[model samples]
Target: MRKNSFAIGCACFLVFALLRYPQAMLEAGAKSVTLWFQQVLPSLFPFMVACGLLLRMGAAEIVGEWLKPLMRPIFGLPGIAAFPFFLGIFSGYPMGAKITASLYEERKITLSQAEHILSFCNNPGPLFLVGTVGAAFFHAPFWGYIFLFCCFLGAIATGMLFRLFYFSKSVNDFIPYQKTPSPSITECLPQTIADSIDTITQIGGYIILFGVAVEAMKQTGIFHFLGNILSFLPFSEEFLCAMSGGILEMTNGTFLLSTAPDNLSFRLTAACMLVAFGGLSILCQTLGVLRNVPIKKSRYIAAKICNSLCSGMIFFAMAPFVEKYAQKTVPTIAFLAETAFTIPIFYIKSSIFFFACAFLFALYQRR
Candidate 1:
């Protein structure tokens, strides 16, 4: 009770402070709003609607069965997890949580399966990583792709690790429930669009609030206090400030990181780690989607930490190669990079992983 009250008090104070600094608030708020309108909504809306259509048409179940061998063996999750699992990677952010929670709500997946999916599914989408972070921020599209790939690997590694430590279920343990095939696009399209808009609007609100709050904190020197508190970490104050911004909101963190006096390798690794973490704004959105579910937030946070660390490790390993090639700036590579990820390797790999996991899970169940 006291904690809740304290949180409310803090919120009130922040609101008051922001109101006192209107110019800072507007500048911070506007960029987040523009990013959402210019980038996030345009990219996410179609994906959300398409996913809505696909799952409704029973494509998920069909593909889940086909890929059971991989998913079960690798992730120890039911085949049905493949659809949203792939969406989480490709579509980005709370999609994994949204799709997984929707599945659980419909009784398509179990609580354990939903929570496990949640651990690694809530990651940055390719559009942001490649388009915004990679091209706009780094001036290299290939680097964005590299970060996306690292996060992909990190999510998979996290899934496998969770299979070992968290999920011990057999493939056959998943409750095989029938799905209602809604192939009526004529009837569904309008509703799907409406739902997409609503969801995207809510997500934009989170982005705006977090973005503005981070900028406010920076202007108010709240991060200075944070830097002092974290001074024991053996890193520079600038790095600490960047990380602090990241913990609050990813976009803010990304901007701050660009100003850090670190080498490309160090900054790239940090950026990759931050993207993998998905920041508090995204996590809040995920939890909001899963509000009615019985899963714990700590598990989700642990998953983010584990995946971010894994991404950091992978980035370090790939830095030598990435930096070498990144210097080449091959025009051919850009075209290929642009066209190749469009082919849905995320879906293909997920299917294969699903199939593997299913095969192993069935074997485990039989034993």
Candidate 2:
């Protein structure tokens, strides 16, 4: 009861402060809202919907069966682990945590397995990395792919570590395992789309809220103060600033890193490390999804650190090669002409075309 009261008191104080600075609050809130509607939502929504439909439609069993041979040997996990592993790589961020929780809640995975999965699965989505961060911010689409590749490598390294310690399962151990039956596409379409939208909206809310909080910190110069403290160490000012922002929120931190006055390798390394760490916001989302399941917080944090370190090392190793080629991959004018003029129309048309194709295929399959 005392703790609850103290928490409430703290919350009230924060609210009061924000109200007192209505201008700052409004500006911060607007920026957060714009990032959601304009950037995050468009990039992640399609993948979220696709992942939801895939998972519910029994794509897990299919994937699990196919990947079982390699997954068991390499990851020390049952083939069922493939679902969240792959989705986390592609769908990004909290999706891995969310899927892991679903697997646990439905008794598809054990507590230990779920814990190991969290160590590696929660990652930045490829679309955001490649499209938004790479193309829009860095002006190098290759950087996005580089980040994605390093993330996958880092995740695999983390998995190998876990396989040696926590997971003792071998290829022969899971032969008896079975998967859930998926519904026909027509049968699951409505729920798939609905659940995807709901999850995306919740994710959007968290992103926006965290964005505002980061903005508030910036407005108050807290990040600079934090950077000053870090300057005592060997880290650079740019990295310190990036870390200060990334520590709270993933997207905000990555965005900040892009603008940091550092070499491409330094900035890219920092961004990849932060993505692997996944910031506190990502962890909160992960734990919230896993609230019902038994999880060891200390172990989880340690795993994330290990994963981050692994990602950082891999990023540095290939970064020189990446930088050498990324800048010259395409001419500026041609790239601009395509991105500015040709892509939007093609993207919209392709999206519509695919949806129509899926609709027709579903109808035929249903009959």
Query: Against the true structure, whose lDDT is highest?
Result: 1
Structure candidate 2, residue pairs in collision: none
Encode model 1's per-residue lDDT on 7-26: one tens digit a residue: 89868867976888888889
lDDT of 2 by residue, 1-367 (tens): 8869976974675576477677887787787777778766786677776776777777777777656555666677777787898788888877888788777776767777888777888877777667666666667666777777788889889888866557554333444556556688888778767866776677677766676667667776788999998898666777788888898886677777877777767888988898888897777766765678788998888888898999999999987754665744433422112342122333346547854764565445446
Candidate 2 Cα deviation (angstroms), residue 321: 3.4
The clash count for each model shown is: 20, 0
TM-scores for the candidates: 0.85, 0.80
Q: How well does candidate 1 score on lDDT at residue 252? A: 64
- Candidate 1 vs. true structure, TM-score: 0.85
The top-ranked prediction according to TM-score is 1
